[model samples]
Target: MKTRTWAPYALIAPTLVLMAVFLVYPIASVGWFSLRHHTVTQPWKNGFIGFENFRRMLFEDQLFWQSLVFSAKWVVVEVGLQLVLGLVLALIVNETFVGRGLARSLVFSPWAVSGVLTTGIWILLYNPSTGIFQQLAQWGIGDAGTSVLGNPETVFPATVVTELWRGVPFFAILLLADLQSIPKDLYEAASVDGAGRWRTFVSITLPHLRDAIVLSTLLRAVWEFNNVDLIYTLTGGGPANQTTTLPLYVARKAVDSHDFGYGSALTMAGFVILLFFSILYLRLSKFGSRA
Candidate 1:
């Protein structure tokens, strides 16, 4: 027993050490920095200023609140659409058909692409002069010089669609894997009972997929909350900060304003919000209850 216990620890020692160095240490450092008045531009003012950064963020920053609201909206809209579309895609691809292998690969290909590349592709598509809109205009479908990204009225929806193109595939792939793991016997039994497709799905398929759907939604929510690359590259929170998210706000704080202390405080606030939401979501959803 002693040897076994020691061997397990020895095997895991490197992983634990790496986690400490990479994850725990950075988190601890950020916490420490949050209580200070550190700024790259104003080095002379760098020092401890307990709770001041938090105070400013809470009471004085309008942009912080705006970004927080936008972040909530962004996560909700993006995750909801992605979940619906992805579930449909997963179900369709799960069905046995000719060319299914190639279809699955093609449908899932977007999830493998990097966010930067996705943003670049979207930028080209959304461009005013030579984009899809222009091509369509040549065929007399719509007006040319339609700037979707530049117009505030269309920017939010445009950004959501761009993200959905990549985000849906992630959900589809994950849910599809879980869908495949479901025992074929259950469906056979349902069919024998003369259960309709909708009834079988509601009774068997949904219950089986409950845990996966809950977990994936949570993870995708967090990811969308933190996602800055596509938005930054595509919109840069343009058209009067309509697309600005909390993470993008933090990036601007740290990068543009050189306010490390304020940025750290914002980061901590985001972490707390995410933790509270995750816990609340799991509790309300009754996750793992079926298992």
Candidate 2:
């Protein structure tokens, strides 16, 4: 009887220990550090400075506000566009037709690429000297040697396009899985009722995808908000920090400037914002309440 009682705890002990060592410890450390002056470059100044980092971040940091705004914009644009495009792609691929398998593979291939690798591939395409724009210009298009990444006017759209190329595939895959789980009878029933394609889709497909759409949008929003690798490699938050997100700013402070204390503070702020928004989004979307 004691063995049975203790066996479950023993089986799960390793996982609990691993979480404690990794997740819990790191989070606790970040909270602790956020109240200090722990700069690697200025060891002599290392000491407890409770809320000073937060004070400066809140009252004095313009870049902090800018990064937050940009992060919000990036998440909204990316999630919205990815959801729409992904849904369209998912619907298209869900249909039975010749070469369907290959087409689906080709469409979803971008999601398999690493962020850095995606950035590298896009860099080649965005290169002013020998990129697609230059080739188009040679064929009497817009202009020769267009600096898509370098120009501030065009950088945001260019970055958005690059991210969309990778992000949309993720949405497509998730929505497609949910799409497949939907009952054929529901769609057929609508069809038998003399419903048009658009009516059937609206009445059947969208209703069934509501929960999945909500969950996916929330997940994608969080992921995009925290995304750093592709933006870090592709834009480096460049063109006067125009593309910088909150995570990118934190990376700059921690990794580039060796300001762990300030970075921890920024990280804490990000955590709060993400948690708040995630809760609000789930609440507003009525996630998990659908029958």
Per-candidate TM equals 0.93, 0.94
The lowest-lDDT stretch of 10 consecutive residues in candidate 1 is 1-10
In the range 35-75, model 1's lDDT, one tens digit per residue, is: 99999998999999999999999999998999999999999
lDDT of 2 by residue, 1-291 (tens): 446577899999999999999999999999999999999999999999989999999999999999999999999999999999999999999999999999999999999998899899999999988999889888999787568888899999999999999999999999999999998998788888999999989988999999889888988999999999999999899999999999999999988999999999999999998889788787867767884
lDDT of each: 0.93, 0.93
Candidate 2 lowest-lDDT run of ten:
1-10
